[model samples]
Target chain A: MRVFAALVRQGMKVMLAYQWENYMGLVGNFAFLLLFSALWSALLRGDPEAQARMLSYVFIGQLLQNWTFTPTWELAGRFRMGDVALELAKPLSLPVRVLGDFLGRNIVRVLRALPAFAAVGFLMGIRLPDWPQFGFFLLSAGLAWVINASLYVGITLISLWTTYFDQAHQILDFLEGVFSGFYVPLWYMPPALAAIATYTPFPGMFFTPAAIFSGGLQGAEALSALAVQALWAGGSLLILYGIWLGGVRKMTVMGG
Target chain B: MLHALRCYLLLVGAQARAQMQYRFNFFAQVFSMIATYMGQFIALSWLTDRFGSISGWKLEEVILFYALAILAWGFAVSLFFHLVSFEDQIREGLFDRALVRPLNPFVQLLAGQSPIAGTGQLVFSIAAFLWATGRAGVVWTPLKLLYLLGVAVGSALILGAALVTVSALGFFTRRTYTFYWSLVFPARQLVHYPLNIYSQVVQWLLTVGLPFAFINYYPAHVLLDRAADLPWPLLAYLTPLVGVVAFAAAYGLWCLGLRSYVGAGS
Candidate 1:
């Protein structure tokens, strides 16, 4: 825990150094949210029946999409530079190290997202529920972080086998863009497509939690969604551990 | 020029052979790319079903635009893969090696690295193009076929030029990929719907300013017998010409950027 804390501190320092870039990214995120709001405002102008639901879903979806997509560039670079071995040599376990780094980065993201979210809500007239719902939002967000971190670590392990990890990253981006309802609403999808998405782990990272925040899912359904998310997190961790072991065993450190 | 062409072809061939050496990985990449594209196709299909059309264009017309855009994007990705990393290369002093080479620096830089994975996108786009065109019921004349080929090539050049221009900014600002993303994200949206749906300012920005419309929308509008709002129909026919100008400008800017490049290290 101490080691993880230290690593997180280090991550925070690195993040702070890029404060300007993070500010720019925050503004960009807000801009995109505004763009979506404008498009949807144009879309639902005459259709008051679906307006609230659509706005809520779009806002939450954007939040989840922005938050859950992991930046694997640093991990990929570390692997390529053979620094991942040094990380493994540390006292901290692999998952802990990965989670610590991601958690630290996401802490910076959360801070950055706060102002952006406020600006978006102000501009788009989006209002959130009170503290109780916000608590559930926090819980679901924590799960999202875990899921994202696990997937990043798992995907980065593929670097050991192939140098073309960028292709994998692109594929992951496309999948998240689609399955996580980034561009389009999942409800608008064909029943078969939506059914497949429900079975996949992609939605648990973004759509399920987003639905909760947007009030699309509630009561027993929300609990069931959380349960599925827990299962995914556990499954991902297990798969990551397996991959890390195999990757370490097969590791060939080249070109120091 | 012939030697340059031959060398480039040989380099691409070698890249393909190298990729084939890892057959399992190659197949996995292909399958994954196909799956990724399937998601986009499904989304677009759903949107068409709900909205029927965007602006004045039908679903098939929109699909045709998407097909052309993807085809051009695939070509750029395959051919100019190295150009995409030009910023990184400059930042890391990789350009110095290219500068020392006997061949033209642009050729050397372009042919140095290849993306074998992009062949999957290229093949997929071709399939999508054929399917969309067949369904659109457009009669293909020889002239129209020539125009289509020209549009594809022009689109690739325009996109490549845009990439190069963004990459050239690395010489001035080491961290320019963020700006690149801003440009690319918006440009990606242009390939999906007709420019008329956007505000007049955006239409002007996409057409006269960025000139991306010449790559597909303008030529496509003419090809489909749609009424073009541009003053001169000859402008629509000048897709390849527009590409040449853009590429030349980008090349000139690249040279200027190279002059400013402070090579990172030995």
Candidate 2:
């Protein structure tokens, strides 16, 4: 726990060093938000209510983007550079450190996004979620992060096989983004594609939580979403454990 | 001139050959690139499916505009994507190696990298273009075909100029990535959708401020025979002209920036 806390502190310090870049990233994020909001407004020209709901959906998705935007490319690069050999010699758990660092960075991102969220909420007239819904949203979001992280850990483990893990990451990253409804709400997706997305672990990462927060999924439906997320969370963690065991042996074969 | 062209060809060929060495990795990247872009297109289609036309532009028409932007950007980035790394080269004194060389630094930079991944984008865009054309039902006359060809070339040139101009500005500001992330990338992304959907101010910004609209929106409008819908109808015919002027300006800026280079750590 101390090691994880230290790692989180280290991540925050590193992110703080590049504060300007994060602000620039915020600007870029806002640009997309503006662009998409405009599109939705144009599409739902006559229906203000639906437009506002869709806007809220887009806003939540964009806010949670940093959480879902994992790039195992860094891990791949580390393996290629043999930096992982040194990392493996450490006493702490690799996956725990990865999660800690991600959490620390995300804490900063969420803090940075708060003002924008409030400002946009005022402008778009988005209502705050009720206490229970907010609780459900947080719970689902926590599970989503675990599933997402485990998915990335699984992706990073591909470094054990070949140096082309980055290429694989690029493909899976896009697939995850699309399948998870990061850009478009799953309810808005075609019936067929939405059905297909249900089979993937991605929707639990972004769509489920976003829907809960936006009040799109309520009560029983929201609970079902949480159940699905919890199932994915358990399944992905188990798969990650199995893969880590095998990947560690492969890592030793390569040197570390 | 002939000798320079020959050297450029040889260098580009060598780069391509070197990239093809990892056949499996190359194929995987290409396939992923295709899937990535195709997924974006699918998302757009689903949205249009749910809600009808966007600002009077049908799904097919929007797809046509999208394909044009993708093709132009694919052409530009495939050729000049390496320029994004110009800052590192300048900071690390690698620009000195180019300066000491007999060849033009611009040509050397162009030939230094391969663009196989962009080929996937190109393939997807072309396929989408065909699909859109069939559905949009545009009567392609010989003159229109010539105009389309001109537009494609011009759009590619404008995007390529945008890239070169940004990288050239790296000479003045060491951190061009910030400018790129905040400005260039966002502006470029907006072009993927129709400019008509945006507010007047945004349309003007995309049109005059950045000229990204000329890459696809105007050309698509003209080709779709919706010229009267444009604020200034004549703007539809200005893409090729805009491309030439932008490319000329970019070249001038590149020359000026090259002269400004005083070596790393200066």
Candidate 2 residue spans exceeding 4 A from truth = A252-256, B1-4, B176-181, B259-266
lDDT by residue for model 1 over B18-70, one digit each (tens)?
87898887877777777767667767777777767766567788788777778
True contacts kept of 1: 0.18
**Residue B122 C-alpha lDDT in model 2:** 86
lDDT, model 2, position A182: 73
Error of 2 at A75 (Å): 2.4
* Positional deviation of residue A22's Cα in model 1 after best superposition, in angstroms: 3.1
For residues A7-125, write the lDDT of model 1, one tens digit per residue: 78776677777776666565456545544554455456567656666677677666665566466787788888888778677776666776776677767766766776777666766
Q: Which CAPRI level is candidate 1?
A: acceptable
All models: lDDT?
A: 0.72, 0.82
Considering only the true interface residues, what is the Cα RMSD of candidate 1 after superposition?
3.2
Query: How many residue pairs clash in all the candidates, one count each?
Result: 0, 0
TM-score of 2: 0.93
